[model samples]
Target chain A: MNVSRRYFMILVPAAAVAWESVLAGTPEDSPNYKMQDHWWGMLIDTPKCIGCGNCVRACEAENDVPEGFFRTWVERYHVTDENMENPEVISPEGGKHGFPAAKEDEGKYFFVPKMCNHCADSPCTQVCPVGATFVSPDGVVLIDQSYCLGCAYCVQACPYGCRYINPEKHSAEKCTLCYHRITKGLTTACCENCPTGARQLVDLKNPKDPIHAFLKTHSVQVLKPQMATGAKAFYNELDGSVR
Target chain B: MAIFKDTGHLFRFAALFVVGTTSIFVLRAIVTPKSFGQYGHYRGAALKDLADRPVKYAGHQACEVCHTDIVTTKTAGKHAGVNCEACHGPLAKHADDPSNTPAKLDTAVLCVKCHAASAAKPKGFPQVQADDHSGGLACDTCHKPHDPAIAAGGAK
Candidate 1:
């Protein structure tokens, strides 16, 4: 058999094309295809939040959040006057409950629940050296424990101050939006537990969800939007004084 | 002599080619081996595929048939939704022997299978070990697993 140079050239390109196809299609072959639909995010209406800390308790009970480390926290803002910069100032202890009586000299008090922002451009994700912290295609930021090296860069770089270095696992961990639960068609424990309906999970891509409609009707903005991380969590009627 | 030499060369080339191809095939098989276990094949099955046939329970209602009251109590309560099979292991043997009492199923140990103890779930609320469950407080004493009601104060 006379092997032609033309045929050899053709064969090489064909093999390369075949390998590329396999690589491109590898993820589709996975069993967990429904993972694509999951864009785990939350919306908080600061105005609606009663600061009852029901969400905090619910999350703790449901998910088993530890004593020192909280999966979700609330910050209380005390704006004295409409213009004055000096407020009462009592952002204490993650505010598992409402602020302790608004520092005795209360004017205007409100609470903001804080958790993993699950930023589109997460600084925590970018800083992770081992590629453990990653944003999924649906926009939920996450940590893959199987791949984590426990570098703690994710813990340090999180602007929202959510990620923590888990001492027991020796790995950086944070609110994964209850990925195991969410993947199973269940809502996040925090969202499920909120009695006041202050917290709402919404698909940003879906126009039909109340979150999108609310964002349109009322002026809603993300915390530290100037940071430009494109954080999915939005606060409705955010207190300008708190910023 | 030339003819013999040519034939010998052809024979060596043929042997090398056969050995090389066989070796490559064997190496590839070893490197990218398929799953061998029976469970491995079913991993990709959809819910409908899994539930196509009634589960093999051997015509025995098992726990429910014997413990109607417990089943009724559990079902009416919070744990009513939880499948009995989730806690109780396969029941074919248990069904066969009514006299053979089941060893006390450790509720704490069983709950841990779903809720792994992690930083997020630190207390491991449902999983009560012997020390954790002692002091007139078995897991069932405080928590009626079948029906975990949100009590007036709170469900502990």
Candidate 2:
């Protein structure tokens, strides 16, 4: 059928908007992106992290995270002489830029990068009344923002304090483990931007991924093992004082 | 089949039950998404919703295609492993469109960002107190921004 220019012009703008919404709700094919073959996790060598805040800044830019809230941030653990088990932790401005200079030379200091643990046994997913927050087959805990009630149940349920209600979206949001990039076989924005290779995205199922060798040799600890949320974000050289 | 003696009232009650249950089934079919339980309790299509988002940083390889010379220089220097986006910021548009050149960088502010001294940083990560170190001079004045150790030994 032949179409007139007037109808064609009207259809073009409408189609563009409609197409994006359709794609957002539907499943699109990503070649070679197998869910069963991989289980996503992260590795952090805290000793190697320079506290440059590059990872934090990169995550915000890549994910378009709102200011005054973070999808990921760095905390400076100021271990003072007074207390060792409980270090004074501060994350100034979500540690988007480097932290302030240290005032005392008494005790040691270290930086810990924080994001969603993407736990296997996730409390956030369990408490979500709407089933909005859930664990993907690839083992990354994600939120279906479209289905989310914005009740902040997951935010309160999370032991790590990772989830937050996005001020703009008015939806509960946290790290998707950079799902958009990782599913395409690309490393996360934070891992890509880290200068010292301090943070690495690990695929637990991949036999040749080198994290297996490292895990075998190194002593790795997940935050708050006592809570037993089965958090997957692993930290090496984790101080006994860090919480 | 003939257990109930009051057949009229029982038939009406059975029909009401069937209609109520059928209506609920129809409502569920209408309200539910197509790919809701394809994987698990969550909507499986949410994975695609997530994966469909644009990859902002084009990765370091994207920079290597156009700027081979710069990549080579960086590879030879202390900044070898650092991503081009680490300093230049996300330039996915610039990489896609040749005409969309990124803005010029300021070595003054950029250099001190990572190099500034802090107790949390590694003890020997080539940090310096910016005020005492720079002496009101741009970092590039004495050191090459890419290959920092080239000009006058950027490190102590």
Q: A120-152 in candidate 2: lDDT tens per residue?
A: 999999998877889999999999989998999
- The segments of candidate 2 whose C-alpha lies over 4 angstroms from its true place after superposition are A1-28, B1-7, B151-156
- Which candidate has the highest TM-score of all? 2
Q: DockQ of all candidates, in order?
A: 0.03, 0.52
Candidate 2 positional error at B45, Å: 1.0
**Chain A TM-score of each model, in the order shown?**
0.81, 0.86
TM-score of chain B of 2: 0.89
lDDT of 1 at A240: 78
Native contacts kept (model 2):
0.72
- Over all chains combined, what TM-score does candidate 2 have? 0.89
**Ten residues in sequence with the least summed lDDT for candidate 1 chain A:** A97-106
| Deviation from truth (RMSD, Å), model 1 | 14.4
